[model samples]
Target: MTADTDATDAGAAATDVTEPGATPTATDTTVTPATSAHPGPDAAAPAARSGRRRRVGGGLAVVPLLAFVALAFGIPALAMLDGAFTVKDPVTGASSYGVANVTASVQGAYLTALIGSVKLSAFSAAIGVVCGLLLAQAVVTSRSRVLREAVLTASGVLANFGGVPLAFAFVATLGNSGFLTRRLDLTDKGWSLYSFSGLTLAYLYFLIPLMVLTITPALEGLRTQWREAARNNGATNAQYWRHVALPVLAPSLLGGFVLLFGSAFAAYATAAAMVGSSIPLVTLQIADALAGNVLVGQENVALALSLDMVLVAGLVMAVYLPLQRRSARWLA
Candidate 1:
């Protein structure tokens, strides 16, 4: 009786340890191997852990992108946009704010500047595109790799050489009493550093490089076969360009010019330093309003000027929109 009781307790212990997924033991006589049904609790655990890991990895990926956009673009935009609404007073300690600040005189000044800005920007971009395309064409076709490398490097350096230092360089080189003018003694050649010609010349220094950089990819996208096919069919250079290359290059040319125009339009530092009140840019006019006589409702006029700049920028962007869509495949 004692031996039988010990065997029964041992069997009960085995039943408790053996989960539903466990196979019947060789010594068991009742339960069958083919009749096992349920999965053990441990079976689903690895799958759940894998899913958790995937979620964690995905979340980690977005952190850097959000941080980058916020750090670079988000902060500065808020500052500029806020300035358009705030009203400052000279006599009073505090200032008022609202979009009701736009005035007629300011609006007219804005419209005038807008016109000049558009004209100059368009001129720069047109020149830049034509010159840039030719330069790109020359660079890509050259057999001399050394020349290509040197030209590309030089273009990059010159393109970045703008703002205050660039202004200084121009003053030193082309100013009435400057070295180049003295060296060439071209004072009698009828050139003026304070003139539109000078500004356009300086602008091209940066613009050409931008054009070269931007249009190189487009030029490269043109296959040798396209030219060969055209030539095989007796297509003249003008004919080929008219029928094929111009269509492809049109979007890029237009887009690049529009961007150049916008850059020239709001350019304050270069124009202010170079021309001052001697040549009244729209930007310089607006800047003058904020410097002194801040009271007596001039704040509204300044705000109006600011809005004009915004509208000008918007028009440039509107032109950019369709060009982007047109160049989507090749430009992409």
Candidate 2:
């Protein structure tokens, strides 16, 4: 009996001990819980919900800006559209919906004003683009931080400094019987402060600075590595500008031109104060129609002219937006 009990104990000890190159028995094997590599559908639901919530929050943040635009711009644009199409008779006090106001706006003196405004804006913007680009390049290349800050500060101030005050300042300095006019004998030299050319000069005062502000960031976006690469590739300064710099900057330059064009196009107070109706401009025509300075009952025509201006602005934006998008790739 003792021998049999000893033999049973030995067999149990042998079962518990695992031997090398031996298969494990059911009693010796441990069962571990199986785990999946990928998360189940239940686990993924919360993540999707969180992502949706973040998107909702982002959309909510833009609501205010959309509301402001709808209130400020949409309402005015709709009003202008309504007024542009509405025609009224002064004597009969009768109203009709037609394109008469729009037709009248684009004919005769109004046409002249539109053409003149376009020419003036194009000329001033072209000049401003060139001059401002050069000035911004100079500022960017300068060693003095103080000079750069001074120039930028002055530009910011001067860009916003327009309207009646700007007109008065220019008149005081460049008008007939004015300080510079008399001293320099500008009138003898066929220089009149109240002429189209003078108006262009006045526009440049603000436009150049605006161009400076607009193009400076683009100029700064030019990477030094590009210059180095160009130099290493046997490019001269002129070649570098023509091949490397100008190409990259073209979109930005065009965008700046568009901005300057719009600014010069819509300007009113300065032109009204300085040149009156001497230089035909759409803005002046609009003012004359609204105030009946030229003819009474032309209010509808004024709205039509404003609509025309808005259309022109839309065209400018159409051109500018594409250029801006293309430039953003390189600059960003």
Model number with the top lDDT:
2
TM-scores of the models, in the given order?
A: 0.72, 0.92
Segments in model 1 whose C-alpha atoms lie over 4 Å from true places = 1-60, 67-83, 86-98, 104-110, 183-185, 293-304, 330-332
* lDDT (10s digit) by residue, model 2, range 274-304: 9999999999999999999989889989999
Which 10-residue window of candidate 2 scores lowest in summed lDDT? 319-328
Per-residue lDDT of 212 in model 2: 95
Question: Across residues 36-150, which tens digit of lDDT does each residue of candidate 1 receive?
Answer: 4765568778888899999999999998998899888677556555656666666785766755455453455555665666676677777887898899889999999998899
- Evaluated at residue 219, the lDDT of candidate 2 is 92
Task: Provide the clashing-pair count of each candidate structure.
Answer: 0, 0
lDDT over C-alpha atoms for residue 131 of model 2: 99
Q: Spell out the clash pairs found in candidate 2.
A: none
